[model samples]
Target: MHHADLFGPVDAGLPEGLVYRPDFVTAAEEAALIDHVAALPFAPFQFHGFEGNRRTVSFGMEYKFDGSGLKQAEPFPGWLLPVRDHAAALAELKPEDFVHALIIEYAPGAGIGWHRDRPVFGDVVGVSLGAEAPLRFRLKEGSKWRRFTLPAEPRSAYLLRGPARTEWEHSLAPVSALRYSITLRTLRAA
Candidate 1:
C-alpha cells in the first residue's frame, strides 16, 4: 500500500507531516540514477571525526561536521532535476526552493543512525533507490518512546515536515542489500 500524502494515521501509523510516495520514479529512471550514483565519488559520512559506513556526495550545500552550519559544496547538477521535481511536489514546494541535495550509497550492512535534519533546514525530502529497508522514526513522550517504521522501498520518496521534521528522529536500520537515497532539503527562512 502506498502512503502518499500529508500525515494522519498512515498505513505505518505515523503522525504529522510524514508524507510518502511509493513509485516516485519510473523503473528506467531508477536504473539511470543508480548508474549515475555508482559513478559519483563519495566520501564516508563523518561526525566528530568518526566515519560512518555509508558514503555520500553532497551538492548545493554541504553540512559542516563541526556543527557550525552548512557551506556551499558543488552546485546542484541538472541531471537530477526530474527526480527533484517529484520530491518537491510531495512536499508542496518548488524544486528550486530546495538548496541542499545529498546522494548516499549504502553498501551491504550499511545504514544511517538516528538523527533529525538540522534546524537550518525546513522540510526533508528523500527518494529511496536500489533496495528495501525499514525507515524508522521515534519520539520521546513522557518517559517512553513512540515509534513507527515505514518500508522504504526502491522508487519511493518521503517527506518529513512539521512535527516529523522537528520532533521525531529517524534512522535507517542496517540493510542486507545495497541501496541508494537522494535527499533534498530546503533552507529555513531567515
Candidate 2:
C-alpha cells in the first residue's frame, strides 16, 4: 500500500493534534539508523522514582524528571544534528524547535509505563524502527477512563501536539521483539 494510506485523522474518537505517518523513512534509512544506534553506548533508563525497562542514550539536552519536575543535562551531541534535522522536517517542526532527543532500545518484553511528557517539553515526535508496537493512550474522566491505541510501525514517525500532548498519557506494552525509537522534543517557552 502507498504510505499515504496509512495516515488519517486520529481514530476511536480521540482528541486532535496527532500526526502518524508510515514510511517516513525508507528501508535503507531504517537500516542505517539501526546500525548507528547499535554502535552507541546505551544506558538503562533511571529516574527519581521509576526505572525504565528499556535502554536509552540521550542527545541534545538530556532531561530527567526528578519526581516533581524536569532537570536538564548536557547538550545534545553534534553528531545528532542530521537526524534531528530529518526528524524536524518529518514532523513539520522547525529544526531550532527540537532541542533534545532520546534514542531508546526496547528488548523483547521491554515496555514503558503510562505517563505524560513533562511540561518542560513541547511537541513530542518519534520515529520507530525494527518492529511494530502499539502506542496506547489513556485519559482519566471522573471515575472512568477513555483509551486508544495507535500502531507504530517500523519506518514510521508520529507527532504529538496540542491536546494529544497535554491531555493524555501514553505508553507501550511489552514488545514482542527488538525495537528502537528516536524521540525528539522541544523545550516549552519560558
Candidate 3:
C-alpha cells in the first residue's frame, strides 16, 4: 500500500495542538495486525464497559518497561520490539519507563465521548487500524471543531505533542465494522 503524507505541519488539524499523519500505517499490515490481536487472549484486549450504560467502553493493553525502558514484559508478543526500534530510529528520543499501550476501540453504532487523554501518562502516540473513523477535536473557547478522518490502515504512526498534546479533546464516530487503534504513551511512576 502507498503511504500518503496527507497534511503538513501548518495545517495539522488538532484541537489539542497535535499533528496528524495519515500515512503512519500501511493497509496490508492493518489486516495482519488485527488478525494477530484477535488471536490474543480477551483479557489483554477486552472491552470493559463501566456501569450499566451502553456507551461507556474502553479497551487496551498496558506494558511496563524495564530500567532502560528498552525492554518490557507484557503478554502481548512483538509489541515491545516496535517501540524499541522506534526509539532507536528517532534522535533525541530515548526509552522511558513510561513507554506506551496498545488500545483498540470498537464504536459500533456510536463513537466515543469527547475527552482529553490523561496527562499523567505524558505524550500520547497512536496508530489507526481497521475501519475509517473520523476523529474530531474541540478547540478551547471556540465553537469550531477540527475533524480528522483517520485511515484504518495498519503500521502507520501518529504523534501528538505540543498544543494538540494539551488543549484539545478528541473522539471518534460510529462505523459499520469494528474500530481499532494502537496508542503508545509513557506512564508516570507512582
Per-candidate alpha-carbon RMSD to the true structure: 5.1, 5.7, 8.4
Q: What are the lDDT scores of the predictions, listed in order? A: 0.87, 0.83, 0.52
Q: lDDT by residue for model 2 over 87-121, one digit each (tens)? A: 78877778878877889999999999889998889
User: Higher-TM-score candidate among 1 and 2?
Assistant: 1
Q: Which candidate gets the maximum TM-score versus the true structure?
A: 1
Listed in order, each prediction's TM-score against the native is 0.91, 0.85, 0.63
Q: Model 1 off-target regions past 4 Å? A: 1-12
For model 3 the TM-score comes to 0.63
Rank ordering of all candidates by TM-score, starting from the highest: 1, 2, 3
lDDT minimum window of 10 residues, candidate 3: 51-60
Per-residue alpha-carbon lDDT of model 1 for 1-190, expressed as tens digits? 4443333333347769898889989899999999999999999988888999999999999997876668999987778887778787788789899889999999999998889988899988999999999998888877766778889999999999989999999999898999999999999889
- Per-residue lDDT value at 139 in model 1: 85
